[model samples]
Structure formats: C-alpha cells, structure tokens
Target: MTELDLQEYSHSLLLEVQADAEAEGTTTPEAFTRRVLEDLEQAGVVANTFTAYHKTHGHEVHGYGVSDSGDTLDLFITDFHLNPLDSKLGKADTETRFRRLLTFVRRCGEGFGQEVGESFDAYDMCAAVGKSLTEVNRIRLFLLSNRVGTWTDVSANELDGIPVTHEVWDLARLHRHATSGVLGEPIVVSFDPPLPCVSAPSNEPDHSVVLAVIPGRVLAELYAEYDTRLLELNVRSFLQVRGGVNKGIRQTALEHPGKFLAYNNGITATASQVEFLKDADGQPTHISRVHGIQVVNGGQTTASLHYVMFRDRKDLSQVSVQMKLTEVSPDQLTEIVPKISRYSNTQNRVTLVDFSSNHEYHVRFQQITRSLWAPAKDGSGKETHWFYERARGQYTDGLANARTPAQQRRFRDLNPTSQKFSKSDLAKYVHSWHQLPYWVSRGAQKNFNEFMARIDEAQPRVDVLYCQRVIAMAILFKAVDRIAASHGAGSHKSMVTTYTVARLTLATEKRVDLDRIWREQAVSTTLEDAIDDLCPRVMHVVTHPRDGAHVGEWAKKAACWDAVSRVRWAVPPTLEAELLDHPLDEVVAADDEASSAARGEVTLVSPEEWYAIERWAKETRNLEPWQRQLAYSVGRKLELGQGVPDTQVAQALHVRNEAHRLGFRLAS
Candidate 1:
C-alpha cells in the first residue's frame, strides 16, 4: 500500500479529540474550530468543508465548499470562548463580534483573487479557480460563541450585486440543535400581542390549520433570522428548483405593493404544534410559538418576498401575504407534511412522487415488513416483528405508544432495537448498493430526495421479498462499517461510508453472488461473516486509492465514485469461495447446517426485559444496532446462567449499569 501523509485530521476526528480534551480540562484551537465545523455538519447547515488555513490570508476566511449548484461557498468562522457559560461578554462586546463577521463578509466580497493568489490551490480554498471554482454565491459567517446577543440587524441583503445572508450559531442555538433530535425541541416563534389569526380544527385530534395575514417584511425577517433551518425538505427542494427569486414577485412588490396580496396566492405552511397567548377574556390573541414551521406551498412567493423586500429594498408594508399553517402531531409529521406540500404546489412542475411517502416502493416495503415475521430467538417463545417506519417518529410515538405492554413486547421480540432502520436510512443503503455512494453521503434528507427523484424517473417497482432483501443489505452494510471502524479507518464514520460500501459492493458484485445471498430475504450469519471478511480490504481500497494518492475529500465528491467504478483489484481465494459457492452446495453444506441450527436457538434473554431494553434503546439511549445486540446477548446470558459465573456476572452487571445509565427502569 502507498503511504499518504494524513497529517491533518478530519473535522470529525478533531471533534473526538476535543471531547476527550475537554473531559480532562484542556482544549486546543484546532480541536475547538474543528468541533464547530462538526456541529455545523451534524445540524445539516453544511455538507462538506475544506480547510483553507493559509497562514497570512486565512484570517477572514476559515474554509470553503461548493453549493449544490456548484457555486463557491465561502466560510468565515470565529471561535469565541469555548465555554459560553463562562463568558462575560457584554452587549458592546457581542456587537463588536458581530461587526467583525460583517467585515469578513465584506472581505469575501472584495474578491478571492485579491485575498489570495490567482491559483486556486495557492490559497487552498478550491482546486481550480479558473475551471470549476466559478463565483462565490454565498458567504456563511459562523460566529462560534457561547453568548447569544440581541443582534437583529444582520439582514438579508446584497454585496457587490451578489445576494448575501448570515446565520449566527450561538451557544444556546447550538446546544438546542444538538439535543433537538433526542428531546424533540419546539420551534418557538414569539409574536406581538393581538396577533390576528383564525384556527380550524380537523377530525384528527392533534391536527389543525391556522390562517393569518403576515406582512411580507415580517416573513423576510424570519427567513433571514432562521436561514435554511426554517424551511422543510419539500419547500427547501422547491426553492432550489426555482433557483433565486422569481422576477414576477419583484415586479409585483416594486410596482403594486398594495395589490400584491390580491394578485398572489400567498403561502401554505405546516408546523408540528402551535402555542397561543390569550387575553383577559381567554380568547387567543397571539401565536406565541410554532414547532417545525415549513412552507408547504408558495415557496416561490415566500422566497420572492424575502428577495424583493430585503435584496431589492422594496416596500412591503402593504404587501401582506395570507399564510395557511397546518399543525400536525409529531407522529404524523413525516407522513402528512409532504402530502400537504405536494398537493398545495400544483402550479410547479415538481414530481409528486418526490414529495410522497405513499409511493409504491414505500408502500410495498411497508407491506413486506408488516407481513413477514422474523423467527424467534433466545427462548422468547414468540416470533419477532420488523416495523418499517416510513414516517418520522413512527417507531416510537406512532406505533409503540398505542400498543399495550405485552403487544410492545412481541414487537420487540421480532425486531430488536438494532434491526430498526428508517426510510431515509434505507434510501442511503439502496443508493449505495447501486454504486451511487456520493448521493448517499449527502445526508439523509438530501439522500432521500435524491433516491425519490431516481424512483420517479425509473419507476422501478419492487416486491415484498425485494424490500426484505434491501433491509438485509442494510444490516450487512452496518456490520461491514463496524469492521472498518475497528480497523481504525475513522474517516469512514460519516455518511461517506455509504459510498465506500457502495464502491466495495460494485467492485465485488460479480464474484459475491448477491442473488444467492438474497434467496432467504434475511441477513444470515454466513452472509454477515462473509461481509466481515471483505470489509477490511474494501476499507483499505477506499482509504488508499491505488494511484498512490490520498482519497481525502475526493471520496465525498461524485468524481471519487466514478474513479472507483473503473478500477479493478484482486480478491483472496477464501473470499472468492464465499462469494461464488452457494450455501446448499456440498462445499458450503457445513455453513448452511450451522445456519439451520441457529434458527431454532433462542437469541433474546427474557421477553419482558427485551421489550424494556428496546424501548430504552429507541427513545432514551438511541443505541446503535451492535450496542443493542451486545446488551441483548448479555441480558440473555444473565437469564440463562442465573448470574452464576463471576465473569458472566461481571459482564451482566456492566450491561445492567449501562442500561441504568440510559434510563432503563430496573425490576422491582
């Protein structure tokens, strides 16, 4: 293998180091900045980042990236006090910090050629300024501070004819965003008193629609305040499809601001829930807060208002747009929100399937998961079930919340917490399996949209068995990922692993005989062991490109996938045998027999304990599949051995303590 100097650590690894350092009461600048970048990546703020840490010219700029449309995305970051809680920055101090960010934005506007050399790699901001690195469309100035200052003047405007917007990820916002996935934080929007609005309740208990007239300026302000975090996936994708602001909106706002509301269809939005403030008479006067606000329709209108009012500097005092806000429960959010978005935006040429969860593929997968039962294991006495959560929060609040304790137990017996995977996760796996690893690395929402776009184009209908096989493929992908991680290929940790695994599958597809492995429509131990054996070699090729070049950021880009697809490598004799030989063949009869024996053995400890562990794993702990399997295996051993052997007792106690740490309740 060729040696490439991986001297500069990735942002993910740097964050890991930062966490370890903080635990020991020490911190480094490299670690802190990288941690901030990692936080931004996790929150879906930015996809891929390249550090341009030029000693002289990297002051106003930290790094750069390419937008989905191939525009240069300049990143200006300021690392404020590592501990915001300990910072005593006053109002003036905070304003000064924000002003510095504005100055940096101005610097980017000055021109990239001026700050650094004409050659792209001279500044290391981009590879080819003359070729692919065209113009800078967005300048994201991230103020990594512990304090949230009252800075509202950072409005959406233009710099040297290019539209500019900024977002401040302060400590409070960062902490809230970091925990939001686990705690389900509400999107709070506090409005003035006497906020005139009308609420219409639906037959569904937790769903409703609220109608209100909001000034175009107000909407622009919110868009400016929240940035992309405000828009849902459907709306966000629509806005991208429409490009920048539509000329029609600007003309209406500029010429007839008073009649703009009458001529326009306004906007349709959705929220998880809405909170209201009441007057002395107990009538709802103002909408106090809204959870998960997303524009379902009139994305063009919403974007136009923001552009016309903010960028065009047009008056919008009389340009009030009607907003129809549909409030759905969290459990129903994923299923209903996209439907609302698609149904409302009929004026656009957007594909309905891309905005639908009821597509034939998803429906077919749901049927397959619900009908087929996994055999019982670890003496549970009941067959296990797999619940394919097509919608967000379906596994927890949607299905599990309505079931009785015993019913939930049976569900857990069939589908352990580890076997649980979401629709978005499935999309990544399916795409990776097809050798589209770059798309898989684009995060869940983007990847889901990408997958659906392909589905809408190809209309490749799948059967129940095919759906089951896809799930089996996902499990095998995860097992291989663990093996790679164990081998210290820490760079494969991100969604990028989807591409690596895809490359591996594509390279080895001819030899592996995937059709034979899929005959049973489940992940068998023989298949798992085969994947485990191949992962190290797969990861090695992925980490070290055969051309004696470091496959660094290239792996995250589409070019890497294209390059890997054209390369060929040698496979070991044993791996070749495992791939080529069928399980029923005499040469592989021993493995087939072992698999048959495993089918009858109990894999779970106790049904009651398994249920509790599964619940804890999904809701409280959010443990990985391997972690859940370990806990289940330990629990089973404890039950079978009655905590007799000292080693067994120690292992059992260790897992029991971990369960307690994850907030799992103990038996009385």
Candidate 2:
C-alpha cells in the first residue's frame, strides 16, 4: 500500500487555494500559462488542465469539471477550489490575474507530480485507469472544468488502479463467509409479490423466469430493491439466538453442549474450503481465499446450466435453431420442460430427459404462420402462449394401466392421434396426482397447498432476504444521500427515486426489454412511483447477506453515518491453529451434525464456566472409592440431560435410565 503524499499538480492546486487572497500579478505570468496548456493539449487532456506558459506567464480559466448530471457549479477563474464558495481571482487587473493564475497552475502540476512520485508504491499505482475508480472520476471532473490534458495512452492495468481502495477490501471481506457463517451469505431467494406475477398481464400465461446467482453486492442490491416496498410485508429474519441466547457468547455456548466446539471447527478453513471474490468479469481478484460460503448442493449435486449448456448434436441435419433458456432449474426442467419447445421459428425440438432415466425422447416439430403479438401491460396482452414455441414431447405411462376392452373404447373416442392438441387436451394427456385428467381436476388447490407448504419450510431464507433488502435500501439511500448533498436535490425521497429508477431500470430483468423501450422513451415518473410502491411487497426467503453488508459499509463511511451500531463477530481460536494444519474436510467432520441450527446445543464453556465445570466435576465423583480414576462428568455446566433425555439437551442431563423416559409406538 502506498502512503498519501501531495504531488506537483497538488502544489499548483494548493497555490490556487493560496491565490484566494493573492492579488493578480504581471502579464509575464500569462505567457507561461499558455505554454503549459499547449503541452497538455499535446498530451490529449480532455478537461480544464492548468498549464504554465513561460511566455504569457500566468494561469487562466481553462475548462470546468463538467458533470452531465446537471448539478449546479460555482467556478473560480484564478484559483483552485475544493468548493464553489472559494473567492474568485478575476477581480485583479487582466495581465496581473493571468500572471498569478499561470503561477498557480504551474504549482498545481508540479505538486501533483511530486505526490504521485512520493506517495504511491508500484503496486498501488494502477496499470491504467477505469471509470469505476474514484480517482479517475476525479480526473474526469478536473478535465471538464480546468485546462486539463486528455489521457493519451495509459495501459488498461494503470486504468484499473483508479478504483482500488481499502473500502473495496472491506466490502469484499463479508462475502467470504456468506453461506454458513454469521456473515450473511449463499442466499436462497423466493420473491414475494413474485416478480412476474405483478408484471404479468391478466391474459398472459405466466412462465417461470430464472434468477441467476450473481456474486457481488451490486447485483444483490439490484434484485433486492427492484421491488422493495412490496418485500417488507410479513418478512422475517433467521438470526434468533439459542437458549439464553441473550446472554453473552460464552454463557450461551456453555448451555448448548458442544455447539462452540463445532463452531471452533467450522471457522478453521483448509486449502479447499475458502472462496474469494472475482472482478466484475468473474476472474479472481482478491489477495487470497480467506473465508467462504458455498452454494448448497441441495438438488443432488447437479451442475449449473452455465457449466454445461447443450449446444451442438452429432447429427448435422437435425436443423439447429438458437433458443434462450432462462429458468432451467432441475425441478422445473424435470417436471415441466417436457412440454416446452426448443425453438419457435424452427422445426427442431429439445427434450429434457431425466438425468437418471434411459427413456428415449419422442419429439414432434411443427411450423405455424406468423400472428400478431400482444403488449406487456394491456389486459389483452396474451391469451395463450407467453413466448414462441416450435416443438413438443410426449411421454406416457403404461397403456396396460388402462382396462383392456374399455381402454380400447375410450381410446377410440379420444383418438390417439391429432396434429396438435389444445391446451386442455394436453393437460388431460398428462397424469394427475388424483388419477383424473389434469386440466379437469383444476390442480390449483393442490398447487396452492404445495406453495404454502414450501413457504413454511423456506421462510428462514425469506427473512434473511428481507434484512438483505433493508441493507440494500439503506446503502443506496446513503450513496444517493451523499450525491444529493453535493447536488441541490431537495429531499432524500427525490434523490433516491431518481437514482433508484435509473439503477433498477438498468439492472432488472423484464419480460419485455425495458432498456429497448427506455431508449425510445425515457422512463415515466409513474413507473418510478409504481416501483417505490412495490418495495414493501418484495420479499426474499433468506437473510439479507448482500444488502445488509453493503449498508454497513456505507454507514461506515462517516462517523455520523455509523451511529452507535455495533456488530459482534467471532472465530474459534482453538480451531485457528488447527486450520493451519488440517484440511477443511477433516474439520467439518469433527463439528456437530446438528442440521437444525435452531436446536439448542451450545456445550462449549467460557473461563468462568470452565471454573464451574471443573468444580462440578470434582463434586460429581463416580462410584468406587478405589476407582478414583473413574471419569467425572461436567453435567451441571452442560445443563443438557433434561426432560427424559429428549431434545438436544438430553445426553448431558445425567439421568441414569434416560431411555426409559421416552418410548416408541408398537406395531399394530
């Protein structure tokens, strides 16, 4: 890390800062200022660059730092200014003003150069500059207003240095332990006021859309705030503590037997367990893998669609057609994708056969005449298909399942063959859970009941999602607040609305391409208001990992922003040395297999509890005086052997015949 030191340009700026009181001097200085400007021009400066002209001998108003955001600016012609309120140097005589301005400009350039040389280490200096960097942005602003030189040919690596900062490191640290740690992580999002449900027109058939897992807080905030107001309702969080959880960590850990021991193990990472952040382009960008939370392998460890996208087949004559596959989750692909077509314009069909099944796919390809398409929000939006389709698949259970003679008669009436079946008939062809025709059965009730059940199990994720959303809102609010404080934006609401709309419209996934339409006609305030209104209804099924962490960073930017917020963090010190020696796999094996973090099981102890345990172990001596070598149990400290040895606390409860305390039902 390079230390901060003022450079030559900084000195020039400093001189201008000094010129606030300095009277303009001789015309000789103006000549000097003009020559410097000429050299800067040769270097390709885009902004108002302060140049020293030995001939004219003074600084002059070059360009102003131009921001397209339309924020008001008060400018100075003679001196450098950090703010608009600084005094102007134009009051002095023309020749004198020009001369002093030239002197100040020279000073700024020399000072900036000095600082660059002294303050930065080779690594801290970027190989190149990029728009993402705050320093580059500062340069951009200076060029717009001052007689700044353009960037001639800085390499890409130099540009990258512009954005690097300690703050970036701070924000990145949270994502390391996302999935399993106290740090928010590997989020399972199920949107409430479901995205497409609200956006879908009444007439359109709803299709599931994919929410691809993105790695950064940027995308995380985008998803959370896209419709935040709608998300807050009935939202919950998953961070409740264990028994006597309110007690400090040590006390709580002591009550829940062995929990702390497991924690000590989990935090100790081996070479394979850690994940680090990548750049926006998904290339590794961190110093090392410190902590990590991985995406769960819940659905039988299937690979991501991204990892193995189906492309070319062996048969060239199959007539390939490009098609977009969005929501291709294993469940949806397994259960519903047999009905989906590979292409809407071509005669090729694709079937998602079970990964374990050996069944052959039967595909039918068809062509249709072009028809008028519907609009997005209109009630007459779409009556049948949501998007285009080309082919279909048929998979039937055994025909032998039908009664012999009656099956033939029913088959004759229904006819085994039709060029194309209607939606209702297609539904009938698919078996129903009740053994009736699927469409006729109106599985709506069944589907709704299943949805409710899922809600019951997945609610913790939703709570986490809500907290995440709150964090995103707070961060965006802070960024906007800072930006607006610089601008004249009247209130927090107005500033947020403008930026929010811009951010959402850019980041959100829409059924119809909003960006395409937005280019033709800018977003309406009504749409912005609609989005704001929708925020409370947008709920996710997990804790807020992204948004919460980001907001914390934002609030940390200033002491006033930080307020009195305190975050409690922990690491298993005992496991720390272990992490250095063993692999993560070994550590995980040693921790608790307690799947339910909700269960009470903290059996670790603090020094105070350790004292109590040793004292109790001394008192609770085992039988046989000669058998002093017998083990002493720290039962009282564990507080576990309770209630017939049931629940997690049972083993430590010390009841001799705990098995008799509970019973199992006998077979009838």
Candidate 3:
C-alpha cells in the first residue's frame, strides 16, 4: 500500500481500537490514550508517535504549535495518567476542607505567638495569609535565586546586601506563604542562604544554617488568608542556633511534589530525581516564607501584592481623641457608609478591620500609637488637644513620624510631579513613610509599597480604580465629619433631630481628590483638602486608658464575623474605572457649569428636645419651630438632672429617630 494510504488505514485502525475497548471501573482519557500508544509502540511504527496523540486534544493541559514539521502538540508528560503508586511514593494526605483549614490556620498563628513569647501583630496576621514574617516585614526583599531547578541572575551581587537572619527567616516566610495559598506556583524555599548572619558566633555553633520548608499546594487556600511574615521570621530566628546553619522543616515539606504536579504520571523516580531525603540528606535549606505572596495596590488586587510594613510607636509620641456623634440611621449611610462593626483580640493588641453595612468605605485600626494629642510637657493626658478630623477622608492612623502638618505638606509638595508614575511613585511615597527597616512599623509600610508595586506591575497592569477610590472616600469622610460635629456627639438627646435632619439635608456623591492623586500626590492634601470641603462629623476620640491598659475603645464588641477581612473588597472592573474621574453633579438645563458643582445642605438641629416636640405635636397634632425648641429644652433639662452628658442626650434622640424609622414607636 502507498505510504499515504497506509497512514489513513493506520489512523482508522487506531480509532477502531479506541472505540472497542472494554469498560473498566474507571477510564481516563490519558489512560486510554496511553493504551493506544503502547499498542502502537509494540507494533514498531516509528517516527513521532506523539504526533497522533497530540492530534487528539483530550487532556487537562497541553499546548498546540505549528512547527516546521506542521501542526504539532506539546503535551505535558505531567498530565499523563497518574500512577497511584508512583504519585503516592512520599506524599501525605492533608486537611483540605474549609473547617479544617480554619482550625489549622488558627493553630498556626496562636502557636506562633506562644513560641515568640509575645502578642501577635498585623505582621503575624499577614504571615497567616501566606507570608513569612521577614518577607512581609521587608527584612529582606525577594531575590529570585532560582526558577524551577535553574538559577537566575540578579546583578550587582544583591545577595551580598542581605543579612543571614533575613535570608534564613525569609525562607520560613516563603514556606508559610506557600502553605497558605492554593498556588500552582512552585512551593519553594531557600536554605542556609549565604549571607552575613545578624548575629553569629566566633566558632561554629550547633545551628548556623536556616531551613525553610514549604507545604504542598493542598493547604494553600487556607494559608493565603494569613500573613506569614512574622511567623516565618520568628521561625527562622528560632531555628538558628550556634552550630552550622540552622536547618528547620515544616510538617508540610514531607509531602511529595506529585501533589503539586498537574498529572499523576511520571512522578515516581529514583531518590536522585527528588533528592527525597529531608535535612539528614543535605545542607541547611531556607526560603522566604512570604516572599512570593504579593499584596497588590494597598490590597486592591490579588494578581500582585507587595509588602506593607508597620509603623514603630517607639520613635514618636502618640495621641488620640473621641467625639460623640449624632446617631444616624444605617440607611442614611446608604451609598455612604453603612453599619460599622469592629472586633478585638483578647489582649486588645491587634484589632481586625471593621466592615461597613454596604461594605463600602470600611475601616480598621491596625495599630494605635500613644496619645500624641496629650500635653507635650505635662506627660499626662489631662490636656485635650481637640483635633478636628474628617474621618472618611484620607485618614491615617499616624504616619511613622508625624511632624507638623505643614512640614509634611511641604515635604510632599516639593516632590517632583513629572515622574512617569503608574505606582512606582506611590511606592516611593509609601516607602518614605518608614524610618527603619527592623522596626515593626516598617512592615506595614513595606506592605503598602509592595501592594502598590504589585498592582502597577500586575500581569495586565492591575486596574487603576484603586487610585480614584481614595478620593471619593476622602470627600465623604470630610462631609461626614462636618455634619456630625455641627449636630451631636453621641448625646442621646440630640440623636433623633440632628441626625435625621443631617441625613435629609445632605447628598452623598462620589468625588475624586484630583490633586492628591494626579499632580501633587500629597498625603496631607489628599486628606485635608478633600475633608476641608465637607462638614465635619462627630467621631468619639478616646485618650489614655483609665489604667494605661486599654488598647482601643471598640475592641471586645467586634465579634461574629465569618469570611476573611478584605483589604480591598473587589469592586466590579467598570465601576473601578469610573472611579478615576471626579464625581460631578447633574447639570441644570440652563447652566452646564452647575452640573459640575455639588449642592450643600445644612443639618444644625438638636436632638434632646425632640421628645418634647413629639409630645407637643402629639397633643396639638401640629408642628412649629418654637414648639420643637421648647421640647428640646425640656429634654435637655431632664438629661442634665440625670447627670447625662449633653452629647448623650442628643444621641438618645438620634437613636430613637432611627428606631422610629425602622417602625419603632418611641414613647412620647
């Protein structure tokens, strides 16, 4: 037969063989294809046997290419039928269920704290999300030492700059990060990394090297939710003793590579392939735990995440204040901020974030610096600084070192506006917020910088909505501040009238702080400028603890949150795009300029006399401004008699108004 005829005839025979196979308990495409290949091999039909297999597209992973030889398939040998015996060689089963994941992560974090003999911080919590303490803390930046089994080049001997402690701890960080994510990315670690140890002994110590062992991908999802940085750094430091290098291993490292490999086939081999033995088999192994787990644009996107280190409280004094606010209904915050909830750990050292009702414009207190508002000379917190704030605007806890607002503004103003900034500018801005690398405060800063870099350089250039969001957020904050301040400060008496009036009076529109984002890119301006335009809302500021023990005011109350705390809740791509432009108002038919302008309303009402007004209105079935004022006076007198603060009296009325709106009939 002619070669062409023979090829066609062969194809037909192969198809017949595949179609006639007897049923097995289970048969996968790979297994069936393998059977066909085996028969063909036995018949001695040479050339490229894979050619036929590639033609039939039936596999989880494979690539198609038009080669010089014509259409060809690049099949993943890894995608072949998994031989249970080969794949299971050294792998261990793990807890992959959600419940088990929750438990395991809790233990991983709590146990890490006990080991470190200190309370956990945001750094530790971040480590739980798949970062090593060191990497998350920016103790050392990730230098891609190896890719797969190959080493890549990093110019100028950057490795020389890293300290041994950072290198070792970094490995632990990477290990934790790997264990926390469901990453197809290789779970890798560095070991006994060659660097100058932070502290080394003159003679060889019992443990000089550091080992970083990562878990397989099975537990990655769970680990991804944690910040493994502190845990990783601490683990590395713990492992380092006075010997050779400290070599440590995680329980997860023992799992076989096959679990991570896509296909079960061809995973088994002689020990040489895997170098299967643990520490006893070779040199100290270490890898950055959180090195690969990136935080994107201040937690805006997941594709790229960078480091946001913390601010050290030791470098400067701390301060705070609380403003009682007029109680407003959750609906008034619709499209505005909804319900705000908070939670604190038992020690109150770490506070998880607060979620808003609509889940927009949420807030969280990562760390609370001391009361910087106190008397500079008195040292006691008796002096009330009485700082006014637009909470919703670009609010910062307290920069690494907050000098005068003017000084910071000048420093920011001097920055050149001409850098071709995508986010590198933001990174530098964030990085500048740091004073030292080792300090805990620097970790969050590093994280913020890293997150920005990640988004700016994401695979597809992470969306720009992250930039616009801060502006709208800033304006609302300022407006809220104003409205609340003019109204009531948590006084029950003014609760109903002032708060309800404020809601009805104002309009909440999304507006961008253009100067803060595009040209000036100033932190203070981002906050002060936007907030200055809005009415100040009443926010309670708390000062020194009655016993120097209280960490935050709303701690113990924050509980019962299920899903993970989101850094940037995912907003639809289109909505985020819209965020770039400043929010404008509807233009009038006769005046286009008016469309760009925002309309303001006033809400300067009292809540205390609301009850008296209600009583008067109920009896006369009519309402008047005079009657309302008298009612407020009556309520205020009653509240004063009870020793309740004026603010409390106002808050009561506000709460009553909200309740009444919700179908609650308050007693006249």
Model 2 lDDT, full chain set: 0.23
Misplaced by over 4 Å in model 1 are 1-184, 193-213, 224-229, 233-265, 271-292, 300-322, 325-339, 347-360, 371-387, 391-413, 457-462, 508-511, 515-556, 570-668
* Ranking of candidates on TM-score, top first: 1, 3, 2
Worst 10 residues of 1 by lDDT: 1-10
* Local accuracy by lDDT, each model: 0.53, 0.23, 0.23
Error of 2 at 18 (Å): 42
lDDT score for residue 268 of model 1: 85
Q: Which candidate ranks first by lDDT, i.e. highest?
A: 1
Residue 582, candidate 1: C-alpha displacement in angstroms: 14
Candidate 3: tens digits of C-alpha lDDT, residues 1-668: 24333233233223322332221111234333333332222111110122111111121111111111111111112122122112321111111111222232233334532342212222222222222222222121111110111112212111123221111111122222223221112223232222211221234321121222222221222123232221111111111111111111111112322232221111000000111122564432322222222111111111011110021111101111111111122233222111111111111111111111111111111011012121222243232221111121111112213356565444223221111121111222222221111111112222232332222222111123332322222223333333443433211111111222222112222233333433222223333332323212211111111232221211111110000011113333433443435442211011223211211000122343356455645554333333344455545655555333322333333333322322223344
CA lDDT, candidate 1, residue 580: 51
Q: Would you estimate the TM-scores of all the predictions?
A: 0.50, 0.17, 0.18
